[model samples]
Structure formats: C-alpha cells, structure tokens
Target: MPNLNNVSSPSLWQRIWQGFLTTVGTKQFFRIFAPWVKWLAILASIFLVIGSVWGLAFAPPDYLQGNSYRIIFIHVPAASLAISIYFALAVLGVIFLVWKIKTASLVAQALAPLGFLLCVISLITGSIWAKPTWGTYWVWDARLTSMLILAFLYAGVMALFAAFEHTANRGKAAAILSIVGAVNLPIIKYSVQWWNTLHQGSTFTLTAAPKMSADMWMPLLLMVVGSYLLVATLAIYRTNTLILYRDQGKAWVKEYIRGQNK
Candidate 1:
C-alpha cells in the first residue's frame, strides 16, 4: 500500500514476450530450460501412466463397440499430437524464415522425427480401430488419405533438412516445406466434416459440448495434455543435444561439458 501506484506493471502479453526474449537471448538457454524440461517430462510420464491405465482398465466400454473403443485413448492423442506438432513446426518455420532464429531452426529439426512418429502411431492405431469397427483396415477415405499426406509432408521436411549440406540452406528448405505443409492441417481437421468419410467427427469441439461422456473423455483429455508435454520435453531434449554439438565452440557449452564431466 506504500506508494504502490508509482510502480509500473506490464501486461500479461508483455511479460510473456519478455520472458521468451530473455530465454532466446541467452547462450545457456538449454541449461536454464533443462530442469524445467525434466520436470515436464516427469509430469507427462505420470499423467500418461494414469491416463492409459484408467482408459484401458476402468473406462466404460462402448455399448456398440465394447472394449475395442478403448484404443481411442492412444489413437486420438497421437492424431491430435501429430497435427498440433506440425502447427508448432510451422510457427517455428516462420520464426526461422523471418528472424533467422538459429534456436527455432534447431528446434524444428528436432521435432521432425517426433512428429513423423506420432503421425505413424495415429495412422496405425486408426487402421487397427477400423478393422473391427468398419470391417476393413485400409480405406481411401478423405480423412485417411489426408492423414497419409500429412505423414508424407513430415517425411519430406526431414528429408529436405538432410538433403542440403549447408546448415542455412537446410533450414531454409525445411522451413519452406513446413510452412507450405501447414495447409494440410486444416484439411486433416475438416476432412470428416468436409466429405462423406468413414472417419468419425470430433468427439469434442470448442463451440459444442463434448460428444462423449465424462467417463470416456476424462482419460482422453489427460492423454492429450500429457502427450503435448511429452512431445515438448522430447523436442527440448533433442534441441539441447543438437545445440551442444552445434555450439561446441562457444565458451558456455565447453564450460557446461566440463562441468558435466566433473
């Protein structure tokens, strides 16, 4: 209460932006984030274990599909992560292209493999779910086809990064491909609604109440949240590894390695 009015307060967005800039400005950014990433990974692991166990053993089985429906706990989360991570890659791509942020490019490179893995998991799980529900494992449906295209896009980005020898050139090519591939995200999201596909509409939406009951959705929500954190932790870990090698000549990195060895 003592002259509090004299103190300046930053807005929420300003504080967030400043925090981001502070992280990006530091040479020891990985060291600063390593503990946080460790914690995030631990939290993700706990939630993932809880969610998977709950969904597999305790969630009520679908009246129509029985226990087979439990796979949604994995498939939905994988699919959601696949799309969400690509969107993240696109954002990183923009940052790299516009600002030439080396960290952003490194992070995008780190995320490519993880994104592709999640996409593969989504496709395989979807196909497994399909055989029991629709009597076929593969279909040329819009949603399915679009998701396949997404996988190819991920592969393409990874390939482009490797195809170039110059680091800047590699980043530019990968960033361009990532930005262009972002169009596929909307296509994947809307394919079920856009066409007469066998794929089911979303069980949840921003504007509508969840189509699923709480017992069915609670674990799904947990899985989705946990998967996001898991991917983020992995991406950060990968980026830190890459940065250590890329910035090996930097004094801080050498000091960090020396400390680790000690």
Candidate 2:
C-alpha cells in the first residue's frame, strides 16, 4: 500500500494552510462585512432591528391577532431559513456524496448545527406566536406539524454525521438523508396552501401579506438578511475547523506544525 502519512521534507504544511485559508479567512470575512456581499447583512440588520423593535413595542396592536402578532418577526425568518437550510444542506450533501470532496462534507457537517438552530428557533417562536393567536401553545396545525418534521429531520442529519466513530457509513448516510429531506421541504411548505388548513398563509406572498404597514416590514427584512449572514459566516468558520480536524495528520499539518516551532 502507498504510504498515506506522506509528510514532506520541510514546509508542505505551510503551503496547505495558506491554500486552505485562501478561500475564507479573516480577510475574506472583512470583505463580506464591508466590501463584498454588499455588506448587505449588516445594513439590512440595522433596518430589521429598528423595524422589529419599533413595531413590536410601539406599533398599534392588530385588531384581530392583537399583541401576539409581535412574534411574527422572529417566527417568520426562523421558519423561512429553516426551510432554506434544508435545500442548501441537500445540495451540499449530494455533492459530498458524489464527489467525496472533502470540503463539501466538511461544509455539510458545519451547516447541520445551523439548520437545527433555525429549526428550533422556528419551533419555539411559532409556539409563542400561536399561543395568543390560536389560544394554545401547541397545535396539530399543518404548518406547525410540517415545521416540526423539519426540525426532527435536521436532528437526524446532525446525528448521522456526528456518528463519526462509524465514519464511512455515517457520511454516506447523512448525505443521502439530507438530500431526501430537501425534496420534502417544498412539499411541506405547500401542504397548507394546497389544502384547507389551520396554519396561516405565508406573510410575503401575493395573496397573503403581513397585515402591517411599511414601517413594520422594513425591520423584518433586515432581520432576515442578518440571520442569513450569521448562519453563513458561522458555517464557514466551522468548516475551517472541521477541515483542520480531518487533515490534522497530513504532510501539510506536520510542515505547518514545524514552522510554528521556529
């Protein structure tokens, strides 16, 4: 068998670390905040925070749902992103499974936790939103039910990936399930729309919109942007850590380890 532990004579580790950092290190992160990605996340977050706080605190209560509507800002973004993450995870999962591309699997692993976080936030916020709106904290409503399924699926994905003592089967299994879950998200999203259901219509859709004025929506949009950046930036950072873990004993790792010694 070929020697897998192929450490080079001197500085191979330094070369690899530089290459790894090339895609998304601190410099790239600054670009996202100030130059690239339009810094849209930060800008949008400002508007969102202002809009959410003002609307939640000082805006007039809905004549119908009353103060409970305040939860929409939190619930809507969480719900939207939870679904979005499934699609992303599925695509990345498929790539990882097909290519066995080390980077892709690392990314999928990094993103699993974020997906779960969004799902949990969506569930908790949905429950809170429902309490005043539906007169109960728990419901078998279509939207709630589907969203719960999403959260569980995310957990399953995470669990599969983290079953690393069984690494070979774990990666393959997680990737397949993530892709399968992605296919189900749209089905879940549209279930309420297609059938008569207790869950409310979508907030930003043409037929259904927020029952609020412009002052109310501006911040909600901002929050959505901020949430996306937060997830993405965190994912990238986590992926870096995972790559290091996976590659720790490589020639590159040894060379870099030596460089730090000098």
Best model number under TM-score: 1
* Residue 211 in model 2: lDDT: 56
lDDT of 1 by residue, 1-262 (tens): 5899988899999999888877773365686777878799999999899899888999999989999998899999999989988998999999989977778888888999999999999999999999999999999999889899999999999998888746548688889999999999999999887888899999787798998889888888888889998988999899888888778898998898899999
**What lDDT does the true structure give each of the candidates?**
0.89, 0.73
Clashing pairs in 1: none
Model 1 clash tally, residue pairs: 0
RMSD of each: 4.6, 9.0
Q: Which 10 consecutive positions of candidate 1 have the poorest summed lDDT? A: 24-33
How many Å off is the CA of 154 in candidate 1?
0.4
Q: TM-score of each candidate?
A: 0.91, 0.76
- What is the alpha-carbon lDDT of model 2 when measured against the actual structure? 0.73
Report the lDDT tens digits of candidate 2 across residue range 1-262.
8876895554888789676556443333333332433454455556567766776777676778777777877887888888888888888787777755556666788888888898898889888877777788897877778888888899998888877635566577788889887767876789888778778777675576665676666666666766776676667667656655666777665665687699
